[model samples]
Target: MQHLETMPRGLPKAVKKCLEKSRDSALLAVETYNKPAIKFKSGGYIVLMVISWTALFHAIFFRQKKKPFYKKNNRFEKKDGDYCYWELSTCVSKYFVADTNNPIRKNLEFFIPLRNMVEHKSIPEIDSDIFAECQAMLLNYDKIMLKEFGNKYCLRESLSFALQLYPSSKSLNNAIIANPSTKPIVDFIKAYRSGITTDIMNSGEYSFKAFLIQVANHQTKNTLPIQFVAYDKLDDTQKTNVNRVAALVKNKFVQVPVTNKDLLKPSVVVKKVQTALGNPKINKNGKEKDKFNMDTHTRCWKKYQVRPENGNENPELTKPEYCVYDQPNDTYLYTEDWSDYLIEEMAKEDEYNSLYE
Candidate 1:
C-alpha cells in the first residue's frame, strides 16, 4: 500500500493529506466489496468510493493551488463551523468543465445520484446489474491517480482479481423478483442507461463489461491463473479471435425491457413539455397563445436531430437519450429525458425562438 511517507517530496500539505485519505478510502471500498461474507456490498462500496473520488479531486485541485470549497457571496460556505467542501458531483463538473460528455465524468455522475438513493436502503439485488459501472468507477480512480501523480501512487500494484463464485442466472432472477421494493432502483438504472448515447453506453470507461472464460491449463505452472487483455489494444486478428471466443460463451441472463410501457407518444411528449414548463404562452400573429404544441415538438426534434424525418430511409438512426424509432407503429417514441431536455432548453427565450425561426 502507498503511504503518506512514500508520497512525492515537497508536495503541498493539503494535497498530501487528501491523497492519503483518498487512497485509504479507495482501498477500504475494494476490501468491503470483495468480502465474501458481506451481502450488501454495493452500498458500502459506493459511500466509501464517493468519498475516495471527492478526496482525489480535492488533492488535484490543491496541487494546482485551487480551493474546492463551496463559496457563498465570495466567501467560503461554512457547515458546523467548518468550511464546506465541494461534493463529488461538483468536483466532476469543475474538473471536466470543458468536456461534459466525457465517459469518466458520466460514470461518476451515475453514482452520485445512485449513492443517495441507496444510502438509506439495502438493494443487494442490484449488485450484478450495476457491476460494470462499479468496476469502471474504481478503474477510473486508479487511472486518474496515475495521470495526476505517478505510478508510485497507483492502486494497481495493491489490488488483485477478487475471487468469486460463478453467479446463477435463475437464483439472481428469483432474488430480484422476491425484492419487489427494488423496482424504483431497477427502473432508474434502465432509464439512465436508455438516456445515454450508444457509444457512451458501450464505452468501457463508462461501464467496464467483460467475459470471464476458463482456458486450458498453461504449459508452465509459473503462468498466472488469470490475465486481463485490453480489447481495444488488440490487433484486428486478435480482436476477431476474442470475439469468436466471447460469442461461444456469452449467455443472456437478463433481457432489456423493450415493452412500450414507458415510451411517450409525440402528443404526450408535447403535453409533458407544456406542463413541465408551466404552460407558458407565446405571441402568435400578435395574440397570446400556447407556446409549445405538436408543431413546436416537430421543430424541437428537427432542431436537435433526435431522429430522422418521417420519410427517411433509416428511421432507427436517433439520439437514444431523447428519441427512438418504433418500427411497429412507424413512429418515433420519446423518453422522459426528451421532455425534460425540452423543458430546460425551451425555457430560454433564444432557444424557443430558434425552434420557430
Candidate 2:
C-alpha cells in the first residue's frame, strides 16, 4: 500500500532517544506481563485485554472528519494524511503511560483482546511472534504517552512547536542498555521513527518530491507503458538514444523576445559540393530544410506589427518579434520535466549551506 511505502530515515537525535526510552518501557511491560509478575492478578489481565483491543481498533481505523478552511460548502471532511500522522503519534504514546485516562491506555485496551484471539486462536492458525511483538510495540507507545500526557503535556502535533529541547544529548544505545528492558521495542520504534521528524527541520519537501515522482512513475506505467515505433524492445543504449532525440525536438519556452529570435535561428545547414575542383560560392538563396517545421515562423510570429511611414508594411524588422497583446489570452501548454523545481531546491540547499559555512 502507498501508505506503507517507507518510514522516515535519518532521524533527529531527540526522536532517537524518545524511541529508546519508549522501547525499554515496552520490553519491561512485556517481560512483566508475560511473567506471572509479582502483581497484576486475573482482573488486571481483563483490564489489559479491554485496553489493548480498543487501541488496536483505533490504530486500524484512526480516520475521522475534520473541518478544512477552503471548502465551498464549509463542511468538514475526512483527510487521510492528518489521521495517519496523529494516529502514529498516538501509537508512539501507547508506550508511555503511568496512570489511567491516557488515550494511549485506551488504545492498549483496544489492542490486547485481538492480540489474545490472534495468539490463542486454536481452531485456525496463530502467530505468537507477531502477537508478542505487537503487544510490546503497543507498550512502547504507552511510554511516550505517559511521559508527555501523564504529566499534563500532550505530545501530539499540538505540542510539536513547543518542544525546543529534545533528547539528542542522550545516546539511544546507552539509554536502552541502561534501561535493559526495552531493547527490542526500542529497536523497533527507532526503525519506524525515521520518518518521524523529516518534519522536525520540516524538510518533508524532499520526501514529498520523491513521493510525487514515484506516484507519476506508477501512473505512467499504468496508463502509458513504453512503446517503441522502430524496435519492439530496445536495449538500454537504444532507449537512451530515443530519449535524446525526443529531447532534441522539444520546443523552448523562452520569455524574452530577442532570445526567442536567437533560438529561431537554423540549428544546422547543408551545402551541396557544386564545385569539387573549384572554390566554393555562397548560394544567393539557400533553402532551409529539416531542422524544424517550416510553419514555425508563422506560429512564433507576433500577430500585430507596426506599418512603415512610406507605405512599407514589413520594414525595418529583421526577425519576427512577439508582443504581449498578440499572444493567445488563455492558452496554456505543458512540456518538460520538473528539473526547474529540482534545480531551485538544490540552489536553496547551496544557499543555506553557504550561509552556515
Estimate TM-scores for all models. Answer: 0.73, 0.17
Best by TM-score: 1
Model 1, runs deviating above 4 Å: 168-176, 251-357
How well does model 1 score by local distance difference test? 0.84
Question: Using alpha carbons, what is the TM-score of model 1?
Answer: 0.73
The 10 consecutive residues of candidate 1 with the worst lDDT sum are 251-260
Deviation in Å, model 1, residue 355 alpha carbon: 17
Model 2 backbone overlap count: 37
Error of 2 at 11 (Å): 31
Q: Residue by residue across 1-357, what tens digits does model 2's lDDT show?
A: 001123244433333333344333333434434553323322233234344333332332322222111233554333664322233234434433354333334334334433343233221111221233344334334444454324221222221111122112233454355555444433332322221223321222111111001123544445643321433267989869766655553323211111111111111101111111122232325863422122321222212121122234534333222111111111111111111222232235354234224
Question: How accurate locally is residue 90 in candidate 2, as Cα lDDT from 0 to 100?
Answer: 41
Best by lDDT: 1
Question: How many clashes show up per model?
Answer: 0, 37
**Residue 160: error of model 1 in Å?**
1.2
